[model samples]
Target: MVFKRMLQALGVGGPSVDAVLTSPDCRPGGTLEGAVQILGGDHPVDVEYLAIGLLTRVEVESGDSEYHTDQEFHRQRLTGSFRLEPGARHDVPFTFPVPWQTPITEVYGQHLHGMTMGLSTELEVARAVDKSDLDPVAVHPLPAQERILDALLRLGFRFGRADVERGRVYGVEQELPFYQEIEFYPPPPFARGINQLELTFLPTPRRLQVVLELDKRGGLFTEGHDAFGSFDVDYATVDQVDWVAKLDGWLRQAAQRRGLLF
Candidate 1:
């Protein structure tokens, strides 16, 4: 009995945990469902809680260069105060709501390169905890989000890169501490007038606030600077509005209205 207790204390013959996600792909503001499977070894163990954390790897600017950092955006506790006997097996199922402001990891089923996101499971047993399993999660854009992206793509803008900044966008209501910026390289039409464009989306129950930042290229007589514009629209407008034409017009207006203070 002493040897058995020692083995259990060392976790040599204790419980093992595995979490399986129902689907690999999910949309922002959608539900993520999964199950945690636990298997007992040679002895019984008191399981305290089963927790799943949703984490995303983000890039942040530090002085001159950028660094990769991991952030846990959300978590869900599936079970608490459970006991597993020797040779016992149990499955704990859970469903969690993904925040509307969740960052997009993929565009149209294609994983954005260099984007790292996953769901990690932690099993709390007694006074010890173990984080032994991680599963990759794919987050796709919502319908309204896709509409805007499609419009930009059709407007001859190429995706540059995406990053989450620590600050909030000006003139927008946001719940999340950080906001996502999706930068785009300008095409021929706006190349001379603009250096780059940054897009940010703040979603609410009724509408989404779209913020556009235009980085203007400095000419021989002018200094380089940025121009900003924000608009709010309901989901219904996504289908009714000609977003491509509307966005193009906005860019052109920004270019002509140079040096105009926001």
Candidate 2:
């Protein structure tokens, strides 16, 4: 019994946790259903509570530098308290709401390079080491988002990599502190003046706030600088809009002519 307690303290023989998702794939603003399966340790243990949260790797900027860290934004409490009897197994069901502005990790069934997310199960154990596990999760894009992305692809822009940048997009009603940047290489037509295109989305219940950052390429006599633009689209009318022409017009008329202000 003493040995068992020692092992439990080290979490070697303590309650083990495994997070199981009903489906690994979900769209932004959707729900992910899952269960936290817990198996008793070698001895009985008191569990304070069970919680599940969504976490992702984000890059945070510091003074003249940036660093990456895991960020957890959404969590759901499973239970107030529970007892794990020796040699027993329990499953705690959960339904976690994916944030409306959750970053897209996959597009059309392909993983976005450099994007990742996890569903982490954390068990609060009393007088014992905490037990937890992290499960991979894939968040897809919404229709409006997909339409814009497809429009970019149609424009000959190639997908680069994506990452979550720390700090909010100024002037945007950003609920979450971080924003996702989907990078793309400018096609041949604009490659002379455009270095890259970075896209971000902040979706509310009624509309999707899209931010575009244009990285300009410097020529012999000019210096390179970044430009930004913010726009909104009604979720109800996303499908009705012709994304190709609309996005093209936005890039040409607004970004090139007037320039996107930071």
Candidate 3:
């Protein structure tokens, strides 16, 4: 019996946990269904609770510097206190709601470069916490978001990379503290005066807020600068608008006018 207990014990005689997701792909404002599988340790343990959360890498700006860190934005408890007998197994099912402001990690079927999102599972046993490895999750764009992205591609912009920044966007009602920036290289026609363009989407249930930022290229006698613009589209009429033309007009005006502010 002693040898059997020793053989069946988990690392350090503590319980082990594995969180499995039904599907790794989901959209913002959707639900992620999964179950936490727990295998008890060599001895009985009083499990305080089980929790799952959504985490992502966010760029934080400090005084004269910037760094990246994993931030857990939302969490849901799976259970209350329970007794876990030695070598016993427990499976707790959960339906975790994804925040409306969650960042997109994939476009179409391809994962966005420089972007990472995962589900973290933590179990509290007798005041001791055991965290499982992060389970990767893909957040796809909504219909309106997809239209905007496709419009940019149609306008001849090439995708560079994407990342989340730890700050609220000016002039936008934000429920989450972080926002994502999708970077793109300017098309050839506008490449002379503009170096790059960044796009941010702030979506609510009724409308989508789009923010555009352009990095202006410096001329021989002029210094480089940045310009910002924002607009909103009702979700119901997303398909009615001609996004390609709308975006093209804005891009042209931004490139031609050096000091334009919108």
Candidate 4:
């Protein structure tokens, strides 16, 4: 979705700007190519610069409460010191590299609920800058990511929800300000001992950091709490590992390690 608005800084008769993204669906570290179209108004305008900003919605925890906020992570200048004549049509094309640590917005072609991402355009006409147009964008997981998710689904774990948190995970190297946590309901055999499961993936050029948090169920003599486990896996193992069995084993071990199951 794209929204367009006249450059308010340029006054009522100023030029209008529209940003169109060629590829709305992209993966992390991929190149996003798009063109910013500028339509001149009744007179010539001195456009100082044209820029694009990448925006996403993030959750922040404040003391005893949590709230959602809009964040702009990336920005670039597409054009500088350009002149537009009356009724002139100009297109400035741009290709920007997405950050490698950008959060995943979709999985298995399904959009994650409660996530909103967009590409916003900024036009500066003689210091009358307008940042009103925003284009929605979608991000998907990589090949290795798909393998892990497939493994979980094959193990009978159902998708509970997915969200982005504004803090870093313990003992993990992160580049972005936020990370994605995908939660799932436990399957049978382990369901009796575990309340919920949360997965966090931090990917690098060569390997992926997998963090698993299990909410253990309590018994008459035990108290309920969370059990955290982290490991690193190479991309080559995506096809080599028997993910279904491996994931099942991981869950069983995690439950036992936390004393959830005897």
Candidate 5:
């Protein structure tokens, strides 16, 4: 409510808004249900509409420079025009679908070090400044996502960091303006072959599109370069896939040398 006081301070009386989420934890391709509780201030006021948005921090680059900023990825309308009478209280319920590409904010019940996601509510009051509210929201990994993460840990690839960068991965089908990258240091067996590994997941309702980036190390009579690979995995059958074996194959393929324009 500290942020809401700005609107309240401008006038003697104005309607106030508070967003309450009934179900705050969700996965990509799922819906978040919530209610906006509106309270009347000193007089009657007309409200134009109410909406909820999913927001996160993202990095943007411009002319060789990059910076981070808060961005809203998706929005859902809750209510149309309405009137708030003196001391009247109203509840507006909403069910908004989380985007299929929604970034994962938590894994195995632990918050990702640098990732954050939230639900922001906007209330436009006629003839008065609009009021706003925000609540912390968590997007958990889907079944396939969970299994991959668990497998990576089991493979001894320690988590390094994660971030959302502004731009699309070349050759990747994505609806969002950006994508999330999860970085890890290579395990003992692959450490000498690779400097590090970056993993990105482009998930749809039916399956997952995984991209792997390998930073290969330079060796005698050779130069180091990045190698890329992409593949699809079914959500229903992902559990059946031998990820450890599959990932090992990917490591070998990505480490193999390829002819270049050089």
Candidate 6:
């Protein structure tokens, strides 16, 4: 309680807030249930508002350089103005909806390197400054997402790292300002032609949109370049397709410089 309390805004005696999540793990399009526990300070104070949101680190490209910054993509207001008496505690329950395009931060119980997710609670006092609290959150992949990731592993792609970028795919439809890229090293078979592979998943309630990017190695006659491919899968038919064979074929085509339009 002491660590969760915000003592700077209202000095030694001010309202403090802590967001307690029932569970820190969830998938996209799911709901995160939690309670906002607010404890009054030594005196009565007017609360301006209470809110919670999903926060993540996003990489932003500026000119020729890129930087990372914290971004709150989704938010929910818990309550409006309220009055708090001395030493009074209030618990407000909330159900925060995770956006469909929210990035995945964990897979197979492992935290993806360079990726982070959190639920942030913000409390604004009428006359004092804003008090805030943050709790780490783990975003797991949907069933369809898991299938594709498993396919990549079966295809011998070693997981490299993952990151969220603050931009939209050139031809993909996205509801959020940022998207995630999971990087992997090519298998031995395709290592000579393909240097690296990157995967991005944009999922909805009914369908999952997948985008693939390949870093092609330079040949004696051609220069190194990148190859792109996009496709969709219906959630109802996710298990019908052989993702490993599909991905291997696509990678082979891209490695041969034939075509990546799938």
Best by TM-score: 2
Q: Write down the TM-score for model 6.
A: 0.93
Any idea what lDDT model 5 has? 0.85
lDDT (tens digit, per residue) of candidate 1 on 103-219: 888997676665677888887788434435788888888888888889999999999878777656777788777778888998887887778998888787678788899998887
Query: Which ranges of candidate 2 are over 4 A from the true structure?
Result: 1-5, 258-262
Candidate 4 structure quality by residue, lDDT tens digits, 76-173: 98888888888999888889778767778888789877778888888777745553589988988878788888898888888888888898898987
User: What TM-score goes with each of the models?
Assistant: 0.87, 0.94, 0.92, 0.89, 0.89, 0.93
Tell me the tens digit of each residue's lDDT in model 3 across 115-180.
Answer: 999999988777444547589999999999999999999989999999999998999878898999
| Candidate 1 collision pairs | none
CA lDDT for candidate 2: 0.87
Model 2, position 11, has a per-residue lDDT of 79
Q: What is the C-alpha lDDT profile of model 6 across 48-127, one tens digit per residue?
A: 89999999999999999999999999999999998989899999999999999999999999999999899999988875
The CA lDDT of each predicted structure is: 0.81, 0.87, 0.87, 0.82, 0.85, 0.89
Q: Model 5, range 1-262, lDDT digits (tens) per residue?
A: 7555655556457877898898789999999997889898986777889888999999899999999999999998888898878899989888889999998988889888789788998888876778888899999998898888888888889888788999999987899999998889988888877878888989987779999888777778988888898889897788788998888776765575443211
Runs of candidate 6 with Cα error greater than 4 angstroms are: 1-10, 219-222, 258-262
Give the per-residue lDDT digits (tens) of candidate 2, residues 144-188.
888889999998899999999988888988888889999999887
Distance from true location, Cα of 86 in model 4, Å: 3.0
The true-versus-predicted C-alpha distance at residue 262 of model 5, in Å, is 23
Among all windows of 10 consecutive residues in model 1, the one with the lowest summed lDDT is 124-133
Q: How many residue pairs clash in each candidate?
A: 0, 0, 0, 0, 0, 0
